[model samples]
Target: MSGPSLYNHFRTKDEILEAVADSVSALVDLSMFEDARDWRTALHEWAVSYRAALRDHPNIVPVLARGPGRRPAALRLADAVYGAMVEAGWPPAQATSVGALMRYFIMGSALGSFAGGFVDDASAYDPADYPHLGQAHLLAEQQEKIDERAFEAGLTALLDGLALQYEQARATT
Candidate 1:
């Protein structure tokens, strides 16, 4: 179905997006992030789930890339991330940074993958002329593996940074 037809079926973009987001979010293991009493465990699991969900649904790329407010799914995910950070004992300031990092990591990686929307068909570059592009394409071919590492590295760094911030907050209080 076309965009217009889809939109007509739904009252507004927000409603459609919310339904889409709700469907996707339901598939995720939210308990992994919420149930973990330890902050590290929750953060790590949340990161892993976010990246995995993004990777699995390449079609949601346009929704996510459009902007947080434009897509209910993105907004829902953002809220969850921020909520998780708060539950982990992060300060309000740190919540924004931490959620932003997770969003950036997942969406940026999704965009990097050729699987996502908006293919650059106009830009043609020879692998011989641009080795980096060529190598990137090869890596994109193995997106699942790359996604795992990206999630792990990004999650570890985010958690470590948040941990430091929490310590600072503790020190002051």
Candidate 2:
């Protein structure tokens, strides 16, 4: 209940943060891929799960962005994802890079987004000074749609690109 009591469980603030990060990471449901036929499925499931975890615990995004550190659950999650990629035919280095890329995308997306930040009022923008921003009024109204579509599009593109790379790698060897 008090700071000293917390210290009994966590020696330092960093420890508490790491624990929180691990707990959040633990939320990722890898079981969704129990019957996954390929790496793409595994990775996609991982991305969705991880993204949901980050979104649910946005306050822990900064801590997760700092890498897994010594967190057990985080490390295990990385290992499972990386192993899936490698088993799916990716070279070790490329698999690691894919993990890093996915993390960057997920963590960046989890941060505060400007989805509905635009002013919907017409008077907020001066047409003569900013002709292109004249239609900015529509942005706020469409923020949710825009954010959801953008995230789906970006995630699809990333997965598609990675799939292409995997194909290319398979062709080479």
Candidate 3:
């Protein structure tokens, strides 16, 4: 749409951003929580879905990173995740923490493309000055693969660590 067209629909940039963010949030997978899968599985599915939505709409990550705000879809997303976590026997506070930590990880991942940050020019990574970065120049070409792998790695680590904590918490309480 043209600038004037956008202005007619949205009074401010913030409104446009909010609308975009809400649409993205609506695309996130929430049905996983309704399944018989365990909490960890449900969380994995949901997070992957959420990340995919954000990754596809990275431009709105900044708005979403601002938190749920009063957006209906974002609030529903939060409510669903938190509710699933608590239903899995996680303490309410810990569930909140889980939701917060996940938002941090997912939104942070969406906020920046690690692969895109690298300079694609081979000359930029001199072996003499940056021996370890020999392959850095190739990162941009493999942006999607690299970013997806990194996100999965980080997500796995977070989930595994959370599992340990969940076990420990269960044992004590």
Candidate 4:
């Protein structure tokens, strides 16, 4: 039923999928430390670009959520990230894991930020019912927080940990 509805509206999933893939691919090429030769710079560039893309096209999250194996663009993006890590001298297995981790973190955080209904201040009520959430909501209002800086910081920390692992592995082998 869903397939026919989707098909009637469009040719195939790939039809819509390709547009997203193309946009993301072009954006990745434009950003992601294209001018820099170092992997650390490339990694930072990739993170910034990924965050910007997610912010620009919050609707694309569902499509990308299908996983790299099922989505050509996602597969290509994953391949590029891992390939860059490998080119930086990390082993293939480590590169693959770290790439996957970075993608998952960025994608998940984007979804959380834009998905709606998750953290709306208007929905916050019954302080005694959900004490912790209510307190956080109050704190958010008090702090006037406008963006997910923590998410970006956590992603950086995760990449830092992966870089450490890469260094250790390189030392051993």
**What number of clashing residue pairs does each candidate have, in the order they appear?**
0, 0, 0, 0
Give the TM-scores of the predictions, in the order they appear.
0.65, 0.88, 0.94, 0.71
Candidate 2 Cα misplacement greater than 4 A, ranges: 2-4, 119-122, 135-138
Name the candidate that leads on TM-score: 3
| Index of the highest-lDDT prediction | 3
lDDT of each: 0.65, 0.84, 0.93, 0.68
Q: Model 3: per-residue lDDT, tens digit, 120-139?
A: 89999999999899999999
Candidate 2, residues 52-121: lDDT per residue as tens digits? 8887899999999999888888998888878877877789999899989999988887786555778888
- Order of models, best TM-score first: 3, 2, 4, 1
Per-residue lDDT of 35 in model 4: 55
The better-scoring model by TM-score among 3 and 4 is: 3
How many backbone overlaps does candidate 3 show? Answer: 0
- The C-alpha RMSD of each candidate to the native structure, in angstroms, is 5.1, 2.0, 1.3, 4.8
**Model 3, residue 70: C-alpha shift (Å):** 0.8
lDDT of 2: 0.84
